[model samples]
Each structure stands twice: as C-alpha cells, then as structure tokens.
Target: MKKFYIKTFGCQMNVNDSEKMAGILRSLGYEKTDLPEEADLIIVNTCSVRAKPDNKAYSFIGNLKKIKKEKPETIIAVGGCVPQKEKESILRFKHVDLVFGTFNFMKIGELIKRAKKERVVEILNSKIPEEDKVPLIDSYLENPYVAYVTVQRGCNRFCSYCIVPFTRGRERSVKPELVLKEVKRLAERGVKEVHLLGQNVDFYNYEGIDLADLLYMVSEVEGIERIRFTTSHPCGFNRKIVEAMKNIEKVCPYVHLPPQSGSTKILERMNRGYTREEYTEKVMMLKEEIPKVALSGDFIVGFPGETTKDFEETLSLVETCVFDQGFVFEYSPRPFTKASNFKDDVPKEEKNRRLQELQNLLRVQAEEKNKKRLGCIEEVLVEGKSPKGKELSGRTKDNKLVVFDGSEELVGKFVEIEITETSPFFLKGKLLQKVKV
Candidate 1:
C-alpha cells in the first residue's frame, strides 16, 4: 500500500530510466502517486544536459527538503545524470536518503532498503554488464501503444559542449538478441511502435550487428507496426541506416540528427567531427533516399568564441536544410566539458539575440514546410487524446503530430487523416478512414 512519486526531467532517455525505476518500485509493492507529499517515497530523477534543467533539478530537490522534514519517515532518493556527475555532493541537500547514478537504477530495491536504515550513495563509474542494465518493463509505460527501448547507453563522442559522456560513461550497446527479445515482448503486449534510444542511437553496434541490422530485425516482429530511433550523430550516421529506413516498411522515415552548429569553424571548436558541407551532404542523402523523411535537428547558437559570421553560417544552414523541426538552444557551458575551459566571450544579450533570430528563421521554415502537407493523406498511429483539446492525437510515420475527432476505440489503431489545417508545431486533420492492419 506504500506510494512513491517520481519527478523526471530532460530527454526521452531520462524518461525511460525513470520508468524503469518506477517499475522496480512497483515490483517492491509500491504504488505510484502524483502528489509527492502523500507518498512514502519521493524520487527526483535529474538531468544536467543544460544549465536550465540542471538548476531546475537542484531547485526541485531543495523544495523536497520541506516534505522530508514534515514527514520524518519519508524516504527521498536522487538519481540520473545530476547525481551521476555530482556524486556525493547531491547529498549536501541533507534530506536525500539515497543517491544513485545513471548506471545504478537496477539496484534501487537494495538502495532503498539501505536508505531506510542510513544514507547511501551509489554511482557506478564503469560500464555495467549486459545482465545488470535496466530491463524493459511493461508496467511503467505512459502510453500502452508506444514504448521506448534503450538499445544502447552512454556516448563515446565527447562533443565539447556535451555532458553526456561524462555523466553516462562510454558507449555500450545492448546485445542484439536482448534488444530483439525486448521488441518481441513489447509487440506481444500490443505495443505498435518502439523507439530505440541512446545518447547517439546511430552509433549503436553490438558485436558486428549495427543499427541498420537492428531495424530490419525489429521490423520482422509481428504487431510492431512502426520503429523509430533518435538523436543520431551525423558523423556516425551512414548510408546503410538510410537504406534500412528506405527498405523497411515499418521503419519510420524520421531522423533526429543534431548538427549542433552550422559553421565548420564553430563545429571544429565544439569537437563535432563533421564539416558543414559533410553534414549537408548527409541531409541530402536522407532526403534523396527517403523522400517523405521528416528531418529534425538541434542547433546551439552561441558557443565560446562564436562570431557574427559563424552565427550567419548557422542561419544559412537552417535556411538551406529547412528542417521540419528544429530545436535551438543558447550555448551554456557544462562542468567537465572541454568547451567550459574556453572563454565564454559571447555576451548574454547577444546570445539571446542570436537564439531569437535562429528560432524565428526555424519557425518560418517549419510553418512553410507544414503548409505543404495540407490536404495530403497521412497514416497516423493513434497514441492517445490530445493534451490541449478533446480531439484524439497521434503521429504520422514521419513523426508529425495529427489531431482529429475519433472515439476511444481508435486509441491503439492506425488511421488515415487528411491534413486540414497546419501549424509550425502540429497538424490538424480530419479522420478519413481506419487503417486495416
């Protein structure tokens, strides 16, 4: 009858980790609660990718101190990237009963037991063996029809501005058999879509089996109607992966390649291993191979020593690529990253200005591209109801969000929709027909 609450921050990887932890807690007879103060245990799953999220995690953990004092028996745990990087320093909050790291979620039961007795901190500094990594748990999926299965962990590419390699350790791929096994199990449980996750998902390789092979293998699983993978590094993404996406019927034609910056000089300074020309070449390859492919990219506006010319080059890249979606961020140095050592010469106001300009350009491009989809019929997998309205919502194969009128019976099924209205962010559609699988 005990209740537990988990507050998660940052990306899909962190969300998956939190789900695994929730599953572990459920197995220990703990029910999840939305209210932190009402729970017997409260967990703050943190992220340190950006200064905003990193500071937010601290603020959240600080506020939990009051709940800990109000309920003396409440157990407080802190886990994820922040704890992985900060280690025992997270315990400075005093009320934190247990602190675990990115690689230590499998030991949650043991840690919680020890925390009940005394304070405990467990941050594994080395690679975790395959048997010890977090397993796919069906119980904690927020969406029954969609799931995120992490096929790889950590990052070998230590980009100058990233904290992932420091917090998550080196790249380690889950065995292909293990990944396929998890995929089959998810399909059997009625999951229609699976998103393979990693810091750099295209870098996934177990033995000689690569991400492209994994895609083909996953497609063979019956009932798995769609497969998507994310956060690919352009340097590691290859033609074979693009071919897999083209040949496999189930593999969604969407790629989230983080270009980071468009200027080759800025890219070199950031330790991103590809030139702007090379990155665009890859983008062109994806577009040529999968004509319907929806391209998503990440851009950092103001890195150390970035100039007006460098910023202009980035704007040109965005303009040329015309990404269907673009996530623009102002560069903020992180602890242990090489970029932190360089002088942060860009003024805050200038960084903000560049960010706004880049964002405006991206928005214009997105709206222009989305407007082209009007009246087109899109195959959408109904994930659930829209958060903003009464309409049912789902995503197309290329990851475009479509909302339309539908019954609850349509939640787990695929349907064809005629794009009626479009915005930079999502598409409003009319349900045309139910797709017979």
Candidate 2:
C-alpha cells in the first residue's frame, strides 16, 4: 500500500475537495500520512484568490522539489485554482508528476492508476463536472462535531475583479433531495453542525428548490442541531434566505456577504451588480428580521481606478456597517478577470497603506463589538483541543471561536459558555454544563 500527504490551502471548499480526494484514493490502497517525507505521493491542493496565496503555492512547491530530488520515486501532484488557472506553468517543475484542475478530482483514481505507469500532467477542466450528492464532512473532518457539504459548484457572476467565472465555470446546484440525504447521513453519524458551501450560495437553485428550501430540509434531519451556509453574494441575497435565517431555529444567525468595495462607483467597476445602498439595505433587512444576527463582509481596496475619495467612501461605509468581522484585500489582477485588461494603476505602496488603514478601522470595530459579548452567555459546539494545549476550542452559533477548559468527552457536545474575556478575534469562556439539544 502507498502513503500520501495532502497540503490543502484556501477555503472550506478546497478542504472538502481534498478530503473527497483522500476518500477516492482509499480504494486504490493509498493511505493518508501526516508527513510528506513518509508518503510516496505528495498532493498540493492550491488556492489562487490573492497574490499571497498564489506565491505561497509556488514557494511550497519549490520546497517539495527538493524532497522529490532526494527521493525520485515520490510523486508530486498540484490541483485546485492555481493549476486551473496556470495549467502549463506547473509542469515547469520536473518533479511534479501530475497537475489537475478543480473539477477533475472525481477521475483522480483513474489518473493515479495511469500516473503509476508514466509521467502525467492533466489540467483539462473546460466544463463543470457532475457533482457528487454525498456530503464531504464525513471521513476526513478534523472535528467530528462539524461537517461541510458542497451544495453547489462553479460561478456565473463574472465580477470584473474575480476569476471564479473563468476557473469554476457557470453555477449549478445539487438537488435538494441529494443534499438532504447527505445531511441525514451526517445526523446519523452524530454530526451536530452542517455548513453548506458554494462560490455564491444564495444563487443555488435546482428543481423548484433553492438555498432556503435546502436549509429547511436539512433542519428537519434528526440530531442536526445547527445549519450554516457561506460566501453569499450581496447581489443575490433575497428574502428567501433572510426568512430561512429567521424561521429555521437550527439555521445559524450568521452571513458572510462579500461587498467587494463599499464605494458604488468602484463596485460598478468591479461589475458587482449591486450598489452600496442596496447592499446595506439587504444587511439592514437581515438585522431587522433577526436582531441578534452577526454580520460579516469582505472589502477590496485600491482597485484599478479607485481614487482617495473612493477609498474614503469605503472607510465611511465600514464605520456605518460596523461589521462584526470583515476581511480587507489589496486588489491583484487575475488572468481571466476584466481588471487584468485595465492598468493596475494603484501604486503598490498606496494599496498597502489603504489596506492597513481599512484593517485598523475594522480591528477597532471588531474589538468594540466583541466587548459586548463579555458578559453574555453563548451556546458553543465543542470541536477539539486548542492549538496551545490544556484548553478546548469551539464556535458560537454565530461562528465566534470560544475557548475553555474541557475534557475529551465534551468534544462533540454543546455547552453553555459565559464569556469571560473578549479579544478582537475570539472569546475566552467558562463552560457551565453540557446540554441536550
């Protein structure tokens, strides 16, 4: 039997995909290992969202090159967004035995069988592959309490600054019955939390079923205590999703709405298909519908034609929205994005300065908002031990991380935690007792 090590990078989708790949490899007698040195095959599941992740992929590949030299029989394969974007470039490294795209993993068992016979480079992903209905949260989950199910695949948005439409292709949703079947299996396995994943989750629609219907269906599954969905687009956020969050008791009161730029003009340039006021209107509606709802968003500073005034608009919007937590990005041109054709006029130094300023403001807001949770009691699902040890970590219903003293027996159970200390990023809490949901 051969051993394999997979270095997964980027979002939960990539994580799910990597886990699925491992499951596929199991039938071929390939066992997963922790160390690259101990494995006969090393797979680098990549990300290409920003410049940092893009560079990190090559840097890690370079390090792996040395390992390949020492042991020539070791096979190094690269998959995911980076390879989907730069298919031919990955083969430049002589040590790399295979290069595949995001949707090509279903054929990996066949690919690996062929690779053992000869060197192969497969980067052919021109169409959206048929999606597997089974949930990926099982077998490969780091935490038994939680799981991620991919309900949809690809994107059709074609936002000017985004490469998702090119790399992932058009959006298509999984059947609601299939989604419910997977959730039912997870419930049977004692999984308490289920997170439905997609590029733009709100746009999910299939056979008279949408995201809201899927959420309601999953909530009906026995032993399923919570449901969450992520990476929703501001343009597609409609009343159905808001109603789901309000009526469905198991649905978490959290939404990650990515408003690329706060300035309407910059947003228009990005082809986001929504205005600043429109985005805030949706956020406001969600809050009004569910008062305790935690709002998080995304921002991109120093876009192609952004001016100082435009950046100030973003800052002003941030102050107005007061996001519970948000992410700020410095624009980087992607190969198939419309921004690539325009001159990247924003000076790198200026972009960095703006990014720092935006992040600083968001940090202050996050700390101030977190302070409100200091005396509040939150229900958190115990996931696993903390990285520093002697402490256990879990997440609140709204997706806030809370750490406390706990035993391994409490790993998959829910406990009421009194917020003792509040940091900008997470909360320190004390568990009262485990509760039955």
Candidate 1 to native Cα RMSD, angstroms = 1.5
Model 1 lDDT at residue 71: 99
lDDT of 2 by residue, 18-57 (tens): 8778877775788889999988989899998887888898
Poorest lDDT segment (10 consecutive residues) of candidate 1: 130-139
Per-model TM against the reference? 0.97, 0.96
Tell me model 2's lDDT, rounded to 2 decimals: 0.86
User: Each model's C-alpha lDDT?
Assistant: 0.90, 0.86
Backbone clashes in each candidate structure, one number apiece?
0, 0
Clashing pairs in 2: none
Q: lDDT score of model 1?
A: 0.90
- TM-score, candidate 1, is 0.97
